[model samples]
Target: MLLALDLLGIFVFAISGGLVAVRNQLDIVGVVVLAMATGLGGGVIRDVLIGAVPPPALDDWRYLAVPAGAGLVTFLWHPAVERLERVMNVFDAAGLGMFCVAGALKAHDYGLGPAPAAALGMLTGIGGGVIRDLLAGRVPVVLRSGELYAIPALAGAAVAATGVELGVRPAVVVVPGAVLASGWRLLAFRKGWTAPAPRVSPPR
Candidate 1:
């Protein structure tokens, strides 16, 4: 179940990456590279941080293939894919929810304390998109956009970590945790919500 959730998250993230590449007019190779990086980058970072060397992504051919397949599909059918931007955004939120919860559980399972595990979980959710945006030469949406993205990821991670720390079953926590994160994200989108920005004075 966990492995399936992980791959679903990777596939969604890869599709988002491929979409970005297509929007940027990147060639086929670039599309695939970006997709693979976005799909695997966060998990790789989380694994390395927890001292799980030689990350599973590197050891598993299926992990590599999923993103590559997503990229190719996006590259070939981008026109249709582009038309589904709104739907894709919702899937991205779902992916974010899955990764954050999974990351927190995995970190806790690896002997990390709740706080650090929660932080790593948030990283697992946002890290790939940050890398994708950077490589694509754009400000990360998490940083610059006034949208409720990272906050929900952090919320989900915290929920998962806190639940585990309190001796709750991980399986019991996963669904509610993911629903909280993704539901909040979708609500924010539907309600036209935006995060506050710092005030700036006009130039004299």
Candidate 2:
């Protein structure tokens, strides 16, 4: 079940990256590159950090297919895809949630402690978007002034990891934990919630 969610999350993030390429007026090659980057960027980083030699995405060719397929779909159905931007956040949130669980779990499996696992979970959640944005010549949204982006993923990862340590039904615990993170993201978006920036005055 966790594996399935991980795959689904990858697919969704790939589609989003592809859609972004479309929005950016990128060429076919650019779309494909962006799709793969956004989809696998975070997971690959997490795996490497956890010492999953060769990385699952690299070892399993299907991982490559998922993102490439997503990019193709975006290319073929651009108008329909464009219309789905509102729904994109929901999928993106889900992706964040799932990746957080997956990353933290992988870290724990590799014998990393709670602190590092939670941190890796946070990276696994947002690293892809950061790569995608950088490739597109824009600052990543998580780095920008936005609603609670990494926080939800962080919360979810921590919850899932703690559950794992407690011998909870990891599958059951993670699903709801992911959902919780997703809910937080969407709610933050809806509420226009954001962290406060420091006060600035006009230059003299």
Candidate 3:
């Protein structure tokens, strides 16, 4: 189940990266490279932080293949893919939820406390997007757009970490954690909600 979720997240994120690369007028090589980077960047960061050397993304052929395939598909069918932007957004939310929950659980397994685990979890959810934006020469959406992205990831990670700390079965906590993050993200998108922004005074 964990592996499946990770692969799903990677595939979806890779497609997103490919789309961004295409929109930025990148070559096919750039599209594939960006896709692979976005797909694996977050998990690699989490693994390195936890001292899990040679992260599964590096070790597993399937992990490498999935993102490469996604990138190719996106490059070939981008117009169709672009037409399904809303559907892609839904998949992106699912990817965020899965990554956050999985990252937190992995951190906990590595002896991290709830707070640290939750922090890493949120990183796992947003790190790929950050790298994607950077590679595409844009400011990361999570950092600049005031979208309800990181908060929901943190919320989901917190729920999973706290539940496990309190002795809940890992399997049992997965759904609620994932649902909270993804559902909240979907709601925010649907409602045109934005995170709170600071008010600025007008220049004299």
Candidate 4:
């Protein structure tokens, strides 16, 4: 179940990365590189932080194949894929939820306490997008888009981590946790909700 969720999340993220590459007019190599980085970067970061060396993404050939496949498809059919941008954003929200929950659960399994596990989970949710944005030479959406992205991710991670710490079965917690994150993200997207930013006075 976890492996399947991880791959699904990777596929979604890779597609997003591919789309971004196409939008930027990058060549096939850029498309593949961005897709791979977006799909695997987060898990790799989480694994390294938690001392899970040779991260599953690095060791698993399937992981590599999935993102490569996504990129290739997006590259070949970019116009059609681009037309589904709105739908893709919805899937991206779902992917965020899956990654956050998976990340938290993995961290917990690796002996991290609730707080750190939740933090890692949030990182896992946002890390791929961050890497993709940097490679594309743009500001990360999570940091500057004013969208309610990270908060929902953190909320979901906190719930999963805390629920597990309270002795709930992981299997029982996963779905609701994912729903919480993804539902919130989708709602924010639909409603045009934005996170509050610091108010600035006019420059003197």
**Cα lDDT of model 1 by residue, 172-199, tens digit:** 8898889998999889999989889989
Q: For model 4, state the Cα shift of residue 158 in Å.
A: 0.2
What pairs collide in candidate 2?
Answer: none
| Candidate 4 RMSD to the real structure | 1.2
Instruction: Give one digit per residue, the lDDT tens place, for model 4 in 3-93.
Output: 7867888999999999989999899999999999899888889999999999988787999999999999999999998888888888889
Worst 10 residues of 1 by lDDT: 1-10
lDDT of model 1 at position 179: 91
- Go through the candidates in order and give each one's C-alpha lDDT: 0.90, 0.86, 0.92, 0.92
Candidate 3 Cα lDDT to native? 0.92
Query: Model 4 off-target regions past 4 Å?
Result: none
Show where candidate 3 strays beyond 4 Å. none
Please, what are the lDDT tens digits per residue for candidate 2 over residues 19-78?
888889999998988999999999888988877978989887888999999889998898
TM-score of each model, paired residue for residue: 0.95, 0.91, 0.96, 0.96
At residue 195, candidate 3 shows an lDDT of 95
Off by over 4 Å in 2: 167-169, 201-204
Q: Over all chains combined, what TM-score does candidate 4 have?
A: 0.96
Model 3, position 69: C-alpha lDDT score = 92
